[model samples]
Target chain A: MELLLTYDVSTTTPAGRNRLRRVAKLCEGYGMRVQKSVFEIVCTEPELLTLIDKVQRIIDHDEDSIRIYRVPKGSFRTVRMFGTAKPLPHDDALIL
Target chain B: MELLLTYDVSTTTPAGRNRLRRVAKLCEGYGMRVQKSVFEIVCTEPELLTLIDKVQRIIDHDEDSIRIYRVPKGSFRTVRMFGTAKPLPHDDALIL
Candidate 1:
């Protein structure tokens, strides 16, 4: 399935900052960066679980939040992008 | 339709930073802030167009990017949120 993952990590402290990096690195391993704190990932159910486990371990429930959206198949047809956010050839422009 | 809006605004210059603040304020008028740069908005088609017009006028075509995703009807049932990202009582939890 296709997923839209976005997170907000508290960065006011050294620990929070470190957690942000670790979470971002984990997300980078599984998907394309949609923005500084957002990612688009396509993975199997098992892979999704694995990714969730990793993220949960790194985030503080009181300090961070993550939103995982299931992008309906073909929903990309309705996606609108402006300026340099235009899809690249190898990006989701060809595949969702 | 329901919309998930996100933007990346260049903040390297004073003008860019000012645009960023203006863009965020504009978005705040139309939607609920889901994160630092993400928003969840529900509006009529015409409202969406108005928002597009306003944002386009404020952003730099070369340095800024905006993405608007149409959230499928009832698809919010599948949304997964962790920590502080959970839906609130008056939020899309009851609408959309």
Candidate 2:
């Protein structure tokens, strides 16, 4: 039900933003926004497939790329525990 | 020192695979291969910037998308504990 879609767009041009907008729109129907350019799409299997199809159609530019990583239903939440900016502690002692 | 580069290519064509090959080649200069299409690139900050530059040059197809996630240096190792297919346990008791 949760997916991590990480993508890159050619920030050098307007076309890139347009492509990203399409991706955002596609995600709107499925899940909540997580981080910048990362969406937490919550949906059933069939709906998620439809969302993927819609996303593929909207992303027509070769300069832009998106990867939809399906984390075994619950991994996404754990990854979020650390947030995005804080790097993990090098000492093994820091892990909970 | 570890980064997760998750990419999607149009498996429908050879161009997508070629783009991925470029990505793999780019990663070779810095780290070890972990899983299929995933690498554990180890390098200093400057080296990583250079690798990203090379990756951009080799990948020219819009049909394929790649996302390079820089883990907080330690998170990748924990994720590995779960492997790729097992879903996280719903009960917090399973977490180490």
Best-fitting candidate, measured by TM-score?
1
Task: Tell me the native contact fraction for each prediction.
Answer: 0.74, 0.00
**Candidate 1 lDDT, B19-71, residue by residue in tens:** 87888788777656777677777678888888899889988888888888887
Every model: Cα RMSD to truth: 4.1, 13.7
lDDT string for model 1 (A1-96, tens) is: 777788887555899779878887887666667666777776778888988988999899887899988876654445788867865221432221
Tell me the lDDT of model 2 at B16: 62
* Poorest stretch of ten by lDDT in candidate 1 chain A: A87-96
Residue A73, candidate 2: C-alpha displacement in angstroms: 2.2
Count of clashing residue pairs in every prediction: 0, 1
Off by over 4 Å in 2: A80-96, B1-96
- DockQ per candidate, 2 decimals: 0.62, 0.05
